[model samples]
Target: MWGRQMFHFLLHWMLGAICFGFLVTAFSVLLSQLVITVVWCSLVIGASIMQDRDLSEYSPTGSSTSKHLSCSHALCEESPNCASPKQPCPYTANYYSENTTSTGFLIEDILHLASSSDRGSKRLVQAPIIIGCGRKQSGGYLNGIAPDGLMGLGLGDISVPSFLAKSGLTRDSFSMCFNEDDSGRIFFGDQGVGTQNSTPFLPLEGKYTTYVVGVEGFCIGESCVDRVSLQALVDSGSSFTFLPDNVYEKVSKEFDSKVNATRTNFEGSPWEYCYKASSQQLLGIPSVTLLFSVNSSFVVDKPICLVYGTQGDNHCISCCFFEV
Candidate 1:
C-alpha cells in the first residue's frame, strides 16, 4: 500500500541542509533541473562532508551501512553502459554549460526526515534513498556552483522525490516557495491551492523527465511585442532567465525604447541592455509579462535590477537574460 508523506525544509538562497540522523549535509537545491541527487565522494578533499566529520566515519565509500547499487537495479537500466549485473551502477550527468559534467556510481543510504504527527508534534523517520556518489566534477562545479552537493527535484526514476514516492513514503509531488529575502520553504507531497494558476507540462521526446511548459508569447507593459511558440523549462537552479536569440533581441530592444534613460555598458557583464538611470526614473519603467495558454499570465513586477559598478559610484539597470 502507498502512504502519503509531507515534510518541510527551510532554504537559504539555493542552499539547504538535510539531517541524515547521524550526519547533516548541505546541498544546493536544483528544483526540477537535475534528474539525480549527487553527493561528492570522499576523494574530494575540503568538501563539506569531510570537514563535518572524521574521514573514516563519514566516507560514503568507507561506510559499511552504505550499499553499492548493482547494475541490475531498475535505475541502472537507464544507463546505456550497464553491462555487468554484478558491477556497481554507473551514472553520468551533463549540464547546459560547456564542459560541465558529473560522473559517478549510485549507492543506497538511509535519509532521516522530520514529519509532523496528528498532534502537531515533530518526529524523525528513516527511509532508504539512492544517491549519486560523484567521484569527479568539472567546469562551473569547481567555481562555487553547488559547492557542497546537489539535491535534484526533477522527474526521474532515481531522483530523491521519485524514490520516496515509489517506496510509498510520500505522494509524487512537491512545492517550493521563495521569499524576497532569499529564504524559502519546500513542501514535499504538497498539492497547492485550488485557486492557483497552472500551466500544463509538455513531454520531451515522449518522456516527462523535466518540467516543460508551453509559452505563447511575451508582453512588455501593455504592448505585445513578439509572438513566440516555444516550450520553456521551469528551472529554479538557474540564477538568470534565458530566452531564444531572436526573442531576446526583440524584448531587449522594446524595453530600451520604452525607458527614458541613457544606454550604458559594463565590461565582462552578461547584461547587454543596461541603462544609466536613477531609482526614481526606474519606477516608471514598464513591467514584463509572459503569456501562456488558457489566458494564464506571469508578471514580472520589478524587471529592472540595480547593479553597482566596480567603483560603486555608477549604477546600471539590468535585466537577467541570456540567449540560448
Candidate 2:
C-alpha cells in the first residue's frame, strides 16, 4: 500500500519538472550483441514513411478543409447543435479544432535482436515497436542526441527490456560498464556488474513502470539540496538531469553562483545558465554531485558532470537541468 502511494505521489510530482531522458531505460546487450532499439521521432521528406489514412482531411498546417469530417464516436454527421465539419472532430484527441493529430502520424514495425552466439543458428530475437512522425528536437546540447527519440527501457509489455524477457532470450537483467577511453558496453542475462553500490529498486507498478531510485539529497559544490528521502528515477536515456521542484530551486541557485560565467547569448539554449567554454569559463563550472540512500545510515555519492555542448557558434559549458 505504501509503495503504491509513493508511485502516485511521484507521478504527480514529476510533471512539475520535466525529468525524462532520451531513453527511459539504459540499453543492454552482451558484448557485440545487437540487443537494443532506438526510438527516434521525426521522419525525413522521403527517408521513411508511414500510413495514417485517418488524417487525410487535415492539411500540413492541421486545418480541416472538409466540412464532412465528423466525429468518429457518433459514426455520422451531426445536426446544427453538433460540431461543424469545418471544425476539428470532437471525438478525436484534438478537441473541436484543426490541430496536430497523432493518429495519421504514428507508425510501427518489427525489430530483430541478434544474440552473442555465432556457432550454428544465430540467436535471433524479434521485438515489436511503435514509431511516430514529428519535428526533431533542437537547441542546447541535446539538439544532436535528442533529435531522435529514446529507446524505451520502461516497465511495459512493449519496452525493449520486456521484449527480451518475453522472448526468453534473457533473464530481464543487464549492466553497463564504462572505460576511461570513452567507450562502454552493456551485458544482459545473469551477467551483472559487480558492485557494492547496489540499492533497492522500486518498481513503479502504475501506467508507466520505471526504474526509480531512492534519493536523499544532492551535494552541489559546497551546498547540499534537501530531497527529504524522496525517490528519483535513474534514466541514462536522458541527455540532461531533472530535479524535483523544491530540490531544483535550491540546486539551480547554487549551480548558478558557482559557475559565475557570463550567461550565454544563444537564443535557443535550453539550460537555465549557459556560459562560453574557455580557460576562464571552465574555472567557474563546478561538478554537481548526487547522494543516494541504500539503507538506514548507508549513503552513496553519485558524481555528476556538467558539460553543455554548442549551438552553432556558441560553446555551451553546462549540462541541461529542469524545474519541470
Candidate 3:
C-alpha cells in the first residue's frame, strides 16, 4: 500500500511538470510573434508619415520656394515687362519650315563668303545669312556625312578641310550649312557648281527632338513640372545634358516625398547630378513647351536632352536640342 501511494505521488508530479513546461513554451512563442508584428507596424506607419510630410512641403501652392519659374521669367524680374504685359518679349524671324531650301536663294554666295581669308569680314557677311541658327563652342570635333554625303560642321581647332575628310564628306562633294540667318534659317548646296541643295540635308530634327522637348517642359516628372522652362541651347557635342541650380531643388523635393522613389542624388557620376520620376501630380505642376522662331517666320520644336542636379541647394541643370 505504501509503495502504491508513492507511485501515485511520483506520477502526479511528473504530469504537472510536463503541463507547466508546455504552457511556458506556448506563451513565449505568442509573445515573441506579437512583438515582431508591433515592430513591423511601427516602421510602416513611420515611413508613411514621413512621406506625407515631404509631399506636403513640396505642393505647388505651398510657398515661394515651392513655385516654379522659367528662365525667361527669372530674367524678366530684373527687367520690367520681362515676363509679360509690363514688357514685350523679343521677336525674331521664324525659320521653321518643312522645306527651307525650297525658298530659292544663292548657294554660291554662302561658300564664297565662308571661304574668305578674312574670318571677321566673312562672319559679318555670313552671320545674318545662316537661318535657324545658334553658335556652338566645342572642345573636340567629329566629321561624318549626312546619309546623302553632306559634310558636318562643328567647332574645334581642326581645319575645316581635314574635318570634312574625316567625315567622308570630302571637300570634293560636301557643302556645309554656312549661311544660316539670325532667324535660325540655314541654306546649303555647292554654290556656282552643278551641286544643288540636297534633300534631307541635315537630319537635325530627329537628333535634337529630345533636347528641345525637355527644355520646352514637355517632359513629365516631379521636378520637371515644378521647374519653369529656362534658356535652351542646341548642343550636339556635350558629353551629357545639364540644368541650372534653381531647377534641381524643386525636382529633388518631389522624389523625397514619395515612398520607393528613386534617390535624386548623384554621387557616382563624372558630374554630380540627380534625377527622379513618378506618375502622380505634384503641386499642380504643368507641362512645358518650347518654341523656336526662325527668320521671324517659322517655329519649330526642340527636344529635351538631359536633366541633372546642380551644386546649389536650389540649383539644377537643363539642356535641349534642335535638329540640324
Q: For this target, which candidate reaches the highest lDDT against the unseen true structure?
A: 1
Give per-residue CA lDDT, model 1, range 222-271, as digits (tens): 88876888676665554445566677777778877788877777889878
Query: What would the TM-score be for candidate 3 when compared with the true structure?
Result: 0.22
Residue-by-residue lDDT tens digits, candidate 2, 143-257? 2322223344545553456666776778886655567773555455655546555656565433235566566665666677665565555544343555545655677677677
List candidate 3 stretches off by more than 4 Å: 1-229, 255-324
TM-score of each: 0.77, 0.48, 0.22
Worst 10 residues of 1 by lDDT: 18-27
Residue lDDT tens for model 3, 164-187:
344443342223232235122122
Question: By TM-score, who's the top model here?
Answer: 1
lDDT of 1 at 128: 77
Lowest summed lDDT across 10 adjacent residues in model 3 is found at 10-19
Model 3 gets an lDDT of 0.24
Each prediction's Cα lDDT score? 0.64, 0.40, 0.24
Residue clash pairs of candidate 1: none
Candidate 1 Cα deviation (angstroms), residue 276 = 1.8
Candidate 2 at 118: error in angstroms?
14
